[model samples]
Target: MIVENSKVILSVKNLTAEVEGVQILKGVNLEVKAGEVHAIMGPNGSGKSTFSKVLAGHPDYAVTGGEVIFKGQNLLELPPEERSRAGVFLAFQYPLEIPGVTNSDFLRLAYNTLQKQKGLAELDLLDFDDYVQDKLKVVEMNPSFLSRSVNEGFSGGEKKRNEILQMAILEPKLAILDETDSGLDIDALRIVSNGVNQLSTAENCTVLITHYQRLLDYIVPDFIHVMESGKIVLTGGKELALELESRGYDWITEEVKV
Candidate 1:
């Protein structure tokens, strides 16, 4: 399927993938539009991360069935870098450490690469430094972070802040944050959420893939979807998250099994 200019940015219908033929997602379906935030919640091993990886074109997870359409094109047909250049960004749950590369350099590479993908000119050293400084302010990161290696020796909070820094700079059309709220203190959570809020608008969409509702308290989503086994069994507004927080997944599992 091909689209020239579509309003729906992402469409995942019956998306199924596997690791070494071990099925993960089963008939999963989701859609995201610009200017909205959608949250995916599930128990352990529920394929939440698999869904993110598949969307991002991770080589290890084989797409055994289903389709993913992003920005009017079949996403699986593109390479991971290509997908990212097309305005799809996935914030990793565990960011890696680059020993030799300073955070500033890595951010510049990512920013310039994204701009190049848009057929825009790359930022010079001066422009790049200014750009990153603005983004750091968005995440409330310390000014000294620029001198450090990419996440080397960063505390849990610092690592998460650095992730947010990337999100703010990229300004992706679709941002999939994988467990972004984990390992953050209250102040850090607020700072990260505040950054996301400042960046989010009606023209950009965000997907918060998380297990706890605590994060939702800060970055309230427009939709909350609960995944179990492999499929999404419940879809509701933010209230559903509060309900789940009080009653647990047992309620939904019992209802579905009955």
Candidate 2:
């Protein structure tokens, strides 16, 4: 578990959202600070993924109520692109394949866009090539991946690696990994976890949304939260994950109801 002096990076207050006219998140509240990793775990339909998407300002979900503050700004008010430029990153469970765009080009464009937003000069192609090469080492990805189309024909592990590689280059202040460990084998899981650990620092925070306790083993979290029926019903330290893994969520759910 990581600790900090307690500078809040994200503060969600009674966050309520819905998708396609169906309510999903129900007043979800959470607080994350720099230098800490928070894991949100729960069964299916618990609205874990919905919360992550809402933070990223996804278009499909509409915020019906509540407030979200990220780095002292009204997060819900920002557009998706603005959120990305503001150092909010989301590594999706399913990375899309862009057939026409090469990975190098895509990454460079994304990186340069964020750089421009930060009032930093955009790297030219020549300099960006050198920069991306260095980031590839973070994920231990092969150079050939840069030449191929984005996520095209890559294995499951490869796609996840690419997502981490993007995080490496982007250096986001808040990284939300939405079940990035879902389909990865043990080896890939370690590799991905290593990258995430390497990137985490006192200046940034990480939020992991996962279903299994296995991921918590590799990336130890400072806080473990149990989400059920669109709300966080319990919060504890790392040991809570082990408890949930052994006892299952039923007992916790029943206890919360009582």
lDDT of each: 0.88, 0.94
> How many clashes show up in model 1?
1
Tens digits of per-residue lDDT, candidate 2, 153-203, equal: 999999999999999999999999999998999999999999999999999
Per-model TM-score versus the true fold: 0.95, 0.98
Cα displacement (Å) at residue 209, model 2 = 0.4
Question: In model 1, which residue pairs have backbone atoms overlapping below 3 Å?
Answer: 35-202
Best by TM-score: 2
lDDT of 1 by residue, 26-70 (tens): 889998877778999988888899899899999999998898998
Return the TM-score for candidate 1, rounded to 2 decimals. Answer: 0.95
Error (Å) of candidate 2 at residue 150 is 0.5
Clashes of each: 1, 0
Stretches > 4 Å off in candidate 1: 1-6
